[model samples]
Target: MREGEKEERTQPFSSPEFAPVKLGGGISPQLIAGRKAGKAEKVHLVIRRLLRQRAIQEGKAFLDLGTDSFYPFFQQYSATQQALQALGDYAYTARWYPSSFGLLQLREEAQRFLRTRFNVHIDMEKELMITAGASQAFDALSRTFQGECFLLPDLAISTIHTIAIANGARPLRIPLHPVSGLVNLQEAARLLEREGRPTIRFLYLNYPHNPTGVCATRAFFEEVVAFAKQFQVLVVHDMDSWYQAHISGISLPNILEIDGAKEVAITLLSFSKEFGLPGLRIALVAGNAEVINALRIHNSEYSVMLPEPCQYAALAALQAFREDEE
Candidate 1:
């Protein structure tokens, strides 16, 4: 090798051009730019892939903090086990279509669960539809309301932000209160004022919020309802963790519990966290009949269904919950 070339290679490298950008909350500006260019997967998917590669090489067990560690509680509950055995007995002849609004029995049970738990009443036929999971629910919403502005918490779920971006929707992150971990409505109002309120489409909310475990109060939800109504924006509340036990010993308020909230808000509920049934992929989307109908029609064209087995499993879990209540 040439002497100068050898010296250059041996020298300590110091180049500003090679400096890396710091990632904050896994949502880096560079990452967002890459997603917009269609060059990146969602953050969790990327992490899972890397972890799988490491596990294969090392042959070591690693805990996935993002998911439950055991099989669903249904496997342990005798009632659900009996229910599943009965379902298997008829598996040969049970016919399920490619698409369904949801099983009538599951929806009816889900409605009862909501009323008994949150004291929130919903029409089983018009106000509720089963989804494969919360992610699919978000996917349907992103498509149904593409190209509109979505207001999201700066530190909330990265999946929601990534999905919104990929679907051509404009997502604006608003800062949450540092201590309370709630969205700053004043700041949100300012953004709406500056960006023109009509351009905004959905106000995203979460309780027993992911990653932070912060719960929303009924008063806060009332304020959110008023804000959404005033702005004429639809609210998408991700209540995926609603069924999970909170450390605070407080019963979480369903956004629908607030009067007038039903006119402006719809909520997504998942059984994964509470029942450890992530693989089953059954969830519910409930709220305003108009918005629910829009999602239903959009999904019909694409054809998505929560399989009968999953519907039945969810029903069994709800029944167990009801029995416990009794």
Candidate 2:
């Protein structure tokens, strides 16, 4: 027997100084054994296999649609190559917890831009929060509010349903009047009175609505806001498509502009449709301080801070727009 082998054989197994040999890197043998025999590996394998199947199915559907040749018209003006180049230079994770709301300069810029463009005033520090996107802002608001019943337009985006469901809320779809292409406020009021249990807590409004391209008039928005205030129900405004259309004379009034709106309404805005930077994932929420704070808290708990690079890029884009206007 070799001298080392003899010493190893004689060594006490009880010695605290002696540690088990690491299999790969610093991974212990027991962990390696567990990984080889664990249900976690099987679960991950199943998920990966299912994802592959979904991808194949989606590819087949795309092929059927002939999407390869038919490029859908994008609303944003930037070209694909330009967008890709911009993204290649973007670095998103240089800050801590995303300033608990967002970067101050970006928020200030957003406030100023929205105010100047839409004629709606927002306090950057008190009433606005920078979010991952309007999608996340809506989600955070819904989660924090914890309502039982939600009223939304029939033509609302799928995200409304998803956020409602995730927040333990039941959704009641109110039809958009075909003639006006706006939420039938009378019908919505009736539905709110009829389907609303004591737990019914809120209603959702969308303008320049999705799937159906209909914009609401100022009078209509005022009426809706009044109804929500009367019923003591919160209102969530999905303004994702606000920038998609240009209305004549009346500078696109946000729900925030309606009388008593700030008392009961939260407005969501996205950078995706407006700037054609969907992947950049910048969005904001403007509303009453209580509501905004609730969302901020929810965000701090459930979401990582928005990447600083995304905020900086969004700032740059906003500055470009301002310069263009000048």
Candidate 3:
């Protein structure tokens, strides 16, 4: 190397051999516009794909059970259609909101129906509220009496835990043992005593239990009532499936029938299972006046009053029951 001339500079660079090199300002306007439009089109394609996948995942194929085969012709008369027509005709006639408690006539009918059919007496004005369904009734009750712990049967429907959790309550499972297709009272009592506390605000009991087909005995219900009373715990008895199965010499016992039960129990019943009118969506809650009142207040704050059509339909059903008895 010459003294005046610096050593020749040398540098090494690394790059992929097959990589596409971008030429600045070399892409045409048309190509640039196409690329921009292509980005939006690809995004839309991806969105459509995701939507279709979700639809396929969630869609259910309809099954027709032909329920009319098991019902009397008159009993099968679609009250829902009649209700819709009635509502259509009276849509603008009144701005009336149903009582926060519920429609008086419906509540009376529910009370009278229970008294006559189940031999369970209730006060219509104070002990009952017409709910959209048993689900909403339970939801309101759970919200009203929010507690740290709930005692639920091990074989309970998923909704029991769901509602409890939504209301910030923890559920403790109580295993249900079977004795001749009824909840084993001894086992239940043991579990109840073992899991229960002052913090346990509610003990959930369901008879003609869903999925298990187990009914509770009068003795079992009395025991539960006693336990609840002793502990000052509340009982939410689900009698939704009471009449679905016919058993000789078996009369469903309401928890409230036990002495001192009014201090510790509330019962829920639904027309869905009994009448095969699930879509009609009507149910009742009955119990101590204070508990019912709290439920009603919570219900009013969180739920819409039962639609007029549902109330009317329930009233008609109750009227039919009365006429049949005569």
* Number of the top lDDT candidate: 1
Alpha-carbon lDDT of model 3: 0.65
Where is the poorest 10-residue window by lDDT in model 3? Answer: 3-12
**lDDT per residue as tens, model 2, 1-326:** 21123333344433133245565566444334423333332444344345444545455321211111112333233332344444447654553545657888888888987777777788887899888887777667666776677787776665666556656666787887879988887887787678644455468877767656677778988887788777777888877744533323444668888877899888888777656567678887898888888888887777647877777777776666666566
Residue 291 local lDDT, model 2: 88
TM-score of 1: 0.78
Q: How well is each residue in 1-326 modelled by candidate 1, as lDDT tens digits?
A: 21123333344332122235455545455445525533232455556656644654575544455553243344575544544554565454248563467878888988997788788899988899898898888878878875477888877776777677766677777889887889888888888888876466578888877767788889899999999888888898888864634334568888999998899999889877666567568789899998899889877878876667767777776776677557
Per-candidate TM-score against the hidden true structure: 0.78, 0.71, 0.69
* Each model's lDDT: 0.73, 0.67, 0.65
lDDT of model 3 at position 219: 76
The C-alpha stretches of model 2 lying farther than 4 A from their native spots are 1-97, 242-250
Winner by TM-score between candidate 2 and candidate 1:
1
Estimate the Cα RMSD of every predicted model relative to the unseen true structure: 11.0, 14.7, 20.9
Clashing pairs in 1: none
Candidate 3 C-alpha lDDT tens digits along 135-242 = 887777677775777777766665666666666666676666644555454665666567654377588888777756676667777888777766677888888854
Better of 2 and 3 by lDDT: 2
For model 1, the local distance difference test gives: 0.73
Sort every candidate by TM-score, greatest first: 1, 2, 3
Name the runs in model 3 displaced over 4 angstroms: 1-95, 180-198, 244-250
**Residue 301, model 1: Cα distance from true site in angstroms:** 1.6
